[model samples]
Target: MTGLRERKRARTHAAISEAAIALFLERGFDEVSVAQVAEAAEVSKRTLFAYFPAKEDLVVHRFADHETEAARVVLARPPDAGPLAALRDHFLDGLRRRDPITGLNDVPEILALTRMVVEAPALRTRMIRFQEASERALAEALQDTAGVPALTARLAATQVVGVHWLLSMDNSRALLGGQSADERCPAAVADAGHAFALLSEGLAAHL
Candidate 1:
């Protein structure tokens, strides 16, 4: 029963969010009001608030998907897998798959979503908060796995997330410049290799 209720709740949440994103994309994020989103989703204004605390959340909800991803990657890695290796491999896989979160995807809707977040001040700020949370989680995971001091774990997490953030932004900017995925992918892959190499002091070192 608990699982069923949670699934129903998730569906409602997604319905409201999908409606909100469609409306925001149609108009602009600043132009859309919570009341209008409620009407579009057929939920009460109060109900909408139950799912998303701020208007910014309606658009950036997807950021929550990755909030603990780095931590999970560290925790679940094979015994021989080093922390940095696990994270780098995960990010490289995301790039190969052209995951939207990696900013390597060139899909039209994804590109538009990237532009929306990049151009909107509120969304960008919210994204920074998400990145900070990811760093914290990664740091905690590193402390547990490596028996490192908290500060050292934190510094390592910062470097890892910083590399990821910069790569994502670079890819987003490339798409924003009107470059097609085909035109940008080869360079993006090569750049990701260089970025990860620098962090791990060369991919060979991580190996």
Candidate 2:
């Protein structure tokens, strides 16, 4: 019964998200209201709020799903592997797969979603908060798993998160500029290698 209820709840949540994204893409994010999203999803305003605390959340929730991903990658790395290596490998894997979060995907819906986030000041601000949370999670992982000092973990997290964000943005720009993912893959791989090598040099003593 509990599993069934959870599954039902997941469906409701997905429905709300899909409906909200569809409407936001159709109309402008600013033009659509929370009430309209509720109506479109067949949920009450209160229920929609229960799932998403703010209007920006209705769009950025997918990003929020990945907020702790870097931390997870660090924690799950092989005992012999370093945190930086795990993250670099994970990102390289994402690029190969054209993961939407890596910003290399050219799917029509993903491109439209990226455009919406870029054009909407509110969404961009929310995304900044998301990045902060991701950094914090990675910092905590470093301190916990590697016994890194608090300050060092935080500084490392800052640099690492900033690097990933910049790389992802570059990939997004290439795709948005009409480059196919396949065309961008080699350059993206080279960029990742260069970025991670730089990070390795800077973080070697600490991480």
lDDT of each: 0.86, 0.93
What tens-digit string does per-residue lDDT give for candidate 2 at 18-80? 999999999999999999999999999999999999999998987876899999999999999
TM-score of 2: 0.96
Worst 10 residues of 2 by lDDT: 58-67
What are the RMSDs of all candidates, in order?
A: 2.3, 1.1
Q: lDDT score, residue 205, model 1?
A: 32
Candidate that scores best on lDDT: 2
- Candidate 1's residue-wise lDDT over 1-207, tens digit each? 999999999999999999998888888887889999999999999999999999998977777888899899999999998888888889888888888888888888888888889988989999888889999999999989877788878888888888889998998899889887768788878888888778777333322
